[model samples]
Target: MVLRNIMIGIIIIVLVGGIICWTLFSKELREGKNLPLTGVDFKRLADGTYTGTYEGGRFKWRANEVQVTVSSGKVARIALLKSTEGRPSEFTNELYDKVIRSQSLQVDTISGATITSKAYLKAVEDALLKAQK
Candidate 1:
């Protein structure tokens, strides 16, 4: 009887772990669909400031808002107004620099900070989308 109980407990634990893993995995997969930012033409955007927000992940790993500045058809600056994540704010700031330097969202994400990187990129993409035309 005791062995049976132990087996049942082990099974319950495995099932619970599997459910948790599946939940996180599916969420990441859904978010991945939105990762690609393409066909953004800087030249087509008007020179001005724009704002955007990407509330991704489980609300705890989100970039609430980002401000982008465009001048003379170039991305001049990017600022993160709000974000919630495990990494330091400086890591997020690196994303802004990458966007400004590359003038595109195709730049690589920061190593060891994939979620924050994606959130920051998404926020920038949102801002650029607003700048279109």
Candidate 2:
């Protein structure tokens, strides 16, 4: 009877630990999930130069800056400009090509790095809006 209780207790402990881990991981995964970049209308942009920043105002992913330029109603070029202390910004950097190629923010976010993708799109949208003004 004592052995049965011990086994049950161990099982319960393992199950609890698994649940905790899954909860934490899921939250992180969701945050990294591609968030639909809403609230910015991209059609109102006009040809001009603008500057914007993203992931800078948030304490979450820690990427420093993403600067972009648009011309003739298309993404002319993008610059990494700056990044966080030690985090690799390459994956996020590559997203610019995808965004430009698609000519919209509907492209897929980078796997394993969704927050940065959202940040990049946000930054681009911001710059475009400023250019319009």
Candidate 3:
């Protein structure tokens, strides 16, 4: 009888934990999808290297940091310094190239990885904001 009760208790705990994890994951995804990104002006940025970070300010699933190098009043290079994915994923790599190429945050996100692309972009934007004069 005691063993049965223990098993039931374990099951209940597992179910509750699963529910909490799912809820948090869903919330983070929703927040990422609706995240607002203000466009920064490249011409106004100073020539220097800047670092930026974004941790969603709440759920940290998308936490990341990036280094942006500006030269001659333009973004010359960008390096993913840190990320939850251990490094830049294919989507993030592609997105970073797009950001550097266009020099804008208005670039299109990866079709299926919009949240991830935005997460990395947010980090890059955080860094670029510091570059603004």
Steric overlap count per candidate: 0, 0, 0
For 9-108, candidate 2 gives per-residue lDDT tens digits of: 9999999999998987777567657444656545555777666655632335645566678787767777777766455657766777787776665444
Report clash pairs, candidate 3: none
TM-score of 3: 0.57
Q: After superposition, how far is residue 18 of candidate 3 from its true place, in Å?
A: 5.8
Q: What is candidate 1's local distance difference test score?
A: 0.77
Runs off by more than 4 Å, candidate 1: 2-10, 13-17, 29-34, 58-60, 104-133
RMSD of 1: 13.7
Candidate 1 lands at a TM-score of 0.57
What candidate 3 gets wrong by more than 4 Å, as runs, is 1-21, 56-59, 87-90, 104-133
TM-score of 2: 0.44
Query: Against the hidden reference, what TM-scores do the models get?
Result: 0.57, 0.44, 0.57
Give the CA lDDT, 0 to 100, for residue 75 in model 1. Answer: 89
Candidate 3 per-residue lDDT, tens place, 1-133, comes to 9999999999999999999999988887888898887888765889999999998446566788999999978888888888875643777778888888887544354455446777888978997998883
Considering only N, C-alpha and C atoms within 3 Å, which residue pairs clash in candidate 1? none
